[model samples]
Target: MADRSLESEQSWKALDGEQMSALLRGSLNDYGAPPAASAEASERFRLQLEQSDQDPMDAFVEAVAGLTDAVERLAEIAAKDPLAAAASIDPSAADYAEIESLPKPIRMTVRTWLGRLLVRSRLYDEALPVIAEVDATESIDPASSLFYRGACYHALLMKQEALTDLRTLLENEDDCPIRFSRLAKLMVADIKPLKEDSLDEISRLMTDVTRRLDLGRSDEKVEGQEQKIIDKLTKLIDKLEEQQQQQQQQQQGGGSSGGDPKNGQESPMQDSQIAGGSGDGNVKKKNLGDDDGWGNLPPAERKEALQKISRDLPTHYRDAIEAYFRKRATDG
Candidate 1:
């Protein structure tokens, strides 16, 4: 009896390999889960990373990074959707839960991300308190702050105030947001318009680029980038020319033959385009690279960032990116 008891008491130290793999099989096969594929792929990549001898870490990092990145992207998307936001909330009352449970910096990071999400969702007023709280405690970029204020003003229909803020952005800003600059110009253009010289200038820029491309220089690296630049210029010229033609046609037809002032007008944003050396926040700031964000960056760094993002984007997207980012002076 004692010997039998001893045999029964022996430690079971091993797990079956089949069982280990089977345990995860369900999670692996969850075809509905977008995240599972990436997560499992990363796990496989990590295993490979562990076994390889040379340069394994590099491959491991490159491969497995997608798992975390996918999740992060999901998080950002969640932040934008009201349903997602509601789902993430604990639903508990705000019973003085101390944010300081984590380190102060980590807590601040959470608030900042939340604030950014709120901004994107157009919950401008709701976002103000959190952003203001952070700004009170820590330095943020003035431009980012200004942008937030401008967005709020625009949403609230404070057009003149928004315009003032935007013009302030234009004047005090040496390098501005390309998207914002373009939108502002478009809005202002609706009220005023390009001078004949301005139209000629745009035409001349495109002509110069076309000449270069025709000279067998288009395939060169510098020429390719230049071609991209010129493509943007040509689009602008085409639009401006169309507008010029319409204006001439209108004169001949005696002011659209008594049509309403707004009837058949060019889209308020159609003519003007992005400026050179504008802020990058308009395109890749959130998508790639990082910005401490508007109102949180230093003046010099903000100007530098604006300069970098002033790329000649595709014509179709120039105005959309602008309106999406900042309120224009007149339209705000």
Candidate 2:
């Protein structure tokens, strides 16, 4: 009997170039040779293939001829106009159905390719469902599936999922392609130290928000992300203000005890009589200052103070803080 272990290993081995070409030719002959049947049409697709250096996966995809020509066009569109490329990814479309009808190996490969294109276009939300259709272990190009899926997960901030896929890809480091290996390492490094709601996380959220805005997506989801960033910044500012207040109080406490003890301290017992107080609950505002009048700072000093407050923040923070205050001002 043949070595069972060797046979099992060969079963999972990726298809070679000749194997892919033979499979494509067999499918073309068996499936009635779609529109790429014409010599001119075939030549057109061939010329398109020549426009790019073919990686192993790309070469396999190119061999599918007419069936995947749409994928080629989609890739081109993604490179030029990502939003248009995003809109074109309808799995229910006839071309996709035609791809689905292909042989299992070809169909899975093509589907994975489509998912990869979606990820490349930064359509992480749409990419997930497409990527889900292929089982990486069963894919002819498992490395590509893992890498692209991990990328989608990374971009979407699905840290655990991204690391899971990336680590699995790295488990076969020697066998994995060097490109995938290097990228996987970088992605792992990025995901490892990420803590939720941190400045780093906030920066990633800002990037995502910017990307959504670039795609002309100012929906409720985008609004929510913007609001989240504002909330985090407000909390940070409040914390800083509280610390400043505590430091000021500490400094004042060191030199002061001149006031009467009874005036400074509150009585534990309540007074028996109730006095007439303002039934209208409005309160007067206090204008606090050093020995000077309130709101009387020179413009240069005020601007310098504001700059000092924000000096430690990221450069883009000035714009974001201004936008936050503008919204608050409008709302108030």
Candidate 3:
């Protein structure tokens, strides 16, 4: 809900090169090398390499494709062998210079897979530069690159930069994978408070509440409460802006006879109270849904009804409703 100018203001700026390099080097040293490939993986790679004799690039692509699959297979074996999945694909085994020399498309693919593997393994700092590299090239699954870069920025405590990237993904990449968009919104919500973008945060929450209501995925009582909060915040912002305009006018009229508060002028606080007090009770009653059906439901009956309906709702929505009730219970 930020205006276009605000959105433009949030554009991403890369971290300082020297600082980023130092951080990556430190993280890599701390993490050390990835565990060597398990025996099964080694044999599979050997066979894959043999098959690639006709085309080395094809073999490399095959190896990259199998990387995640190999980890999953190792995990299955580890369930029984206890040590079978202890090893991971070591990224250092790849010759960076040789990969750099490959065709553009193939090189980008390798970097993309490598970046993803590093991120999945929680080597966020190491993944940061790799993701940035791909992002610079504007190739190799750009959506994934942006997501992982935002994640890396988040992990590194570069929250402003993280918000910039995550917001970009959320706003501009509708065709991006759903999971990435969802995760970006969650991260934005989490980071907004820290950045003091309270209005923007509230706007996002309101948007989400409205969307759920449209989708029939919200509890009536919860939806009403969220709407009430939105209304209250909107009113509050309007009131503050009015006060600001009055102050600015007074400043401009400082040399005029009526400008001085000391000259029998009313205090702004008193003026605001006089203007607002008459409507406060009415606003509160409306927000509390004094005449709404959901507000009239008995607590026990409401809980029972919600539980009965939950079985038919999607898992995500059901979880959201449950969480809402839990929070309300705790708040009460």
Candidate of highest lDDT: 2
The lDDT, on a scale of 0 to 1, for candidate 1 is 0.42
The digit string of per-residue lDDT tens for model 2 on 1-332 reads 75566444332344444455455555555655553463334354345445655665565566554455655665566568654654565665545555456667666666577778778878887788767667776566878888899999999889999998888888666568899899999999998999976667777888999998997899999999888998887776556555555665677775563455687843333566765645698758855757764433355754455567778878777666667678878989
Model 2 residue 273 lDDT? 78
Question: 163, model 2: CA deviation in Å?
Answer: 1.3
Q: Scored by Cα lDDT, where does model 3 land?
A: 0.51
Stretches of model 2 off by over 4 angstroms after superposition: 1-15, 18-53, 65-102, 235-311, 317-319
Off by over 4 Å in 1: 1-113, 128-141, 159-168, 184-332
Tens digit per residue, CA lDDT, model 3, 14-126: 33223323332332233232334323333444455455453222333454334444323433443464222222222343333434444454345445555556566555545
Q: lDDT of each model, Cα atoms only?
A: 0.42, 0.69, 0.51
Clash pairs, model 3 backbone: none
By lDDT, the better pick of 2 and 3 is 2
Residue 102 lDDT, candidate 2, scale 0-100 = 62
**For model 1, how does the per-residue alpha-carbon lDDT over 112-145 read when each residue is reduced to its tens digit?**
4445556666665455554444431221123343
